[model samples]
Structure formats: structure tokens, C-alpha cells
Target: MNTPPNPAAGAASRIPEVATDASLVVPVIEEQAVVRREVVETGRVRLTKTVEEHPETLNFTLLHDEVQVERVPVNQFVADGATLPGVRYEGDTMIIPVVREVVVKRMLVVEELHITKHEVPTQESHQVVLRQEMVQVTREPLAPPTPGPPPAS
Candidate 1:
């Protein structure tokens, strides 16, 4: 006996859906709340310290000597190619730690000099000064406001 093949099974299947306007469709958006933080910068004064910790972490105190100039010329920025405004004992210290993989050079100063940086939130108020000037004009001073009601009667 011969068997007959099913015609519906041989055809490809399609998914079912409803027709809607493409222009009217809009993607949903999520609104989120975010908080911000306040960051403050401060100053400090310190000297170099080399820390060597085995099997843990090591630190290298990178430092430079303090040199003072007798006379400062106009606009030092133009004179020095480097942007260093000046040497000040104020600001954050840059501590670089030494690791096994990193190659570094260590130098020992002949004298351990004091290093200073402005403390964090350093004397910024000092930068501003309010000076009040009073001018005394000799003009009879308005006769004391016309003697003010007959000297309290």
C-alpha cells in the first residue's frame, strides 16, 4: 500500500500580529535620579620619605630642593618654559609607590630639607584683603543734626 503526503506540512509557517501605525510608535524612556558630590582641594608641606615594604607595597618620596630667587622679573611664566609658577610649601604631595615591574631611580639628598605645601583649604581668605578708607572733610559736620530736639528737653 502507498501513503499520501500532507500539503499543509510542506508549506512555510508565518507569525501572527496586528497592524498598527509606525509613526505613532514611540520607545519608552526611563527617568533616573542622580546625586553629585563636592570635591575640595587642599595644600600641605612635607619632606620626602622613602618607604620599603616587603611582600606588600613600597613607596618612593619624589622631592626637589627649594631654591629662592633674589629678584623676580616681569611675568615669570614667559621666562621659564616650565609652567611651575613658583616653589611654595603648599599643596598635595605626589607620592609614587615602587613596584616590582616598574623601573625607578632613587636619589638621596645631601641634606634633608623641609618641604611645604599650602594646607588643604589653605589661607585662601588671606589672599583677599578688605581695606576701608575714611576721608575726613572739614565742613562743620552738619551742626550735630540741628541740636536734636532741644537737648532732650
Candidate 2:
């Protein structure tokens, strides 16, 4: 069977028969990832604060210091060059010496002061008001959009 050659193929074959020594430049294609972000409101939260107060009774012990002072006479003569007595403590009492020069050029101890300290504890009660803040949170969901009438033609 003899078939006539296609006119388009004959035309394309006779167009060009090029012998090239140059390299072919073909563009390479690749896929790249692009990231984007958007904000959407899903729900709403409402916070409420309230202050509350209440009465409270406080109880504790209080300490008080009491001091007692007493003077005792000690009219005693020391030697011509004896050293004067210094302040001394016996247990919790402090004894302070008082010295004076007599007519005979001798040192005399006139009187001594004795001081003692005492601690007294007392129970105390007081009424006071205490305040506290309270917070309440309420979550509301987004309401669906209502459908409106169609736009005017």
C-alpha cells in the first residue's frame, strides 16, 4: 500500500538539520516551601475581679520588762591605797559601788545600788478585718454570622 507523505512532516524535516557543538542551556525547576501565618478569633474570655473582707481575731503573747532598783548602805573604810570596787553582777542582780573620800584621807564606800530586771508575759486579743480579691473568668464562643438579604441588582 502506497501512502502519500504527510505534508506537515515533510515541511518540518526540510526546515533544518542543524549540527551543534555548543552546550544546550536548559533551566532546572524546583519546588520551594513558603510559610505564612494568619490570626483568627475562636472565642472570647471575660475576667471579673471582686474584693471580699472578713473579720479575724488575733491572739498572741506580749512580753513586758520591769526593773527594780534598791540602795543599800555600806559605810566601810578601805586601806590608804586600796583599789576601789568595780561594778559586778551576781546572777541577775547588778551591784554598783559608790565611793567617797573621808576626812582621814581614806577611801570609804558610801552605798551600793542593786538593780534587777523581770519579764512579764501577757495574752492579748485583737479583732481585725482581712480583705481578699477573687477573680472569675467567663469564656464566650464566637457567634455565627447571620445571613442577610441578597445585594441589590
Candidate 3:
């Protein structure tokens, strides 16, 4: 059988239809946290050295050789072809007698000062700690929205 063409039916089809269910179902929108970590410069560390001088006294023993003079009066006559006092060994020291026709002045000498330098090695250690911020995500279900009145018929 042939059905009548209805203009209202065409218009109704163009419009969307609504569901008759009493309870409406909808998707709930949610947001979550994303955690990310990165390395960054928080601060800086520097090492500096300073020098200061102060008066200090040091005592040390120093060994050195020096000349010593001793005079003795001997009224002995010297003849020709006779050996005079010369350099001779006396234990760990050498003794030399300088004979002259006239008396002469003599002096005594001694050791003075000695200086030396020394270098020493040392070790140093330093430690540093770094920190950063991170993001964490958590999710939970929520209650649905309240239903509204049905669409106009």
C-alpha cells in the first residue's frame, strides 16, 4: 500500500529525538596530575684561599767548621836546616803552627745560621646535595550530575 507523504514527519525526522529513560547517563569529566622531574641548577659553590703572615721563632742545630787560634811562648833558638812546626793531624782536627819573627794578633771564628725549606701535601673533600620538584597523579570516581526536565513533546 502507498503511504501519504507528511511534511511534519519530515521535520520531526530532521530534529533529534530524546530518550524516554527516567535516569540519564553521561560521561564525567576528570583531571589528573602528571609527575615530571628534571635536573636544574639550584646554587653554586666556590673555594677561596687567603694567606696571612705572623711572627714565629724556630730553633735548630747547625754544624760547621771554624778556625781557632792558640798562642804559646817558647824561648827556643832556631838553627839552620831544622824543621819548623807544620800542619799535623790531631785526632779529627788539623793543627798548624805559624812561626814568625814578630808576635802577631789572632782571632777566633764560629758557625752562624742555616735556612731550609720543606713542602707538604694535603687532601681536601667537599660534598653537595641537590633537590627538585615532581608531579604525582591520582584519580577517583565522582557522583553524576542531577537530571533535568524532559524535552518538550
**In candidate 3, which residue ranges exceed 4 Å CA deviation?**
1-43, 52-55, 62-68, 92-95, 98-153
Report the C-alpha displacement of residue 49, candidate 2, in angstroms. 1.2
Residue 65: error of model 2 in Å?
1.6
lDDT string for model 3 (27-90, tens) is 8999988776666445444444444444444444444445444544444434545666556665
Model 1: residues >4 Å from true position, as ranges? Answer: 1-16, 20-25, 30-35, 45-153
lDDT of 1 by residue, 1-153 (tens): 676866665553332233564334458999988776655334333444444433433344444454332332232112223332333342443322221211233222222223334323322222333444444433232223333353221
Indicate whether candidate 2 or candidate 3 has the larger lDDT: 2
Error of 1 at 102 (Å): 99
Can you rank all candidates by TM-score, best first? Answer: 2, 3, 1
Please give the range of 10 consecutive residues that has the lowest summed lDDT in model 2. Answer: 17-26
Better of 2 and 3 by TM-score: 2
Per-model clash counts, in order, read: 17, 0, 1
Q: What is the lDDT of every predicted structure here?
A: 0.35, 0.89, 0.50
Overall local distance difference test of candidate 1:
0.35
Return whichever of 1 and 2 wins on TM-score.
2
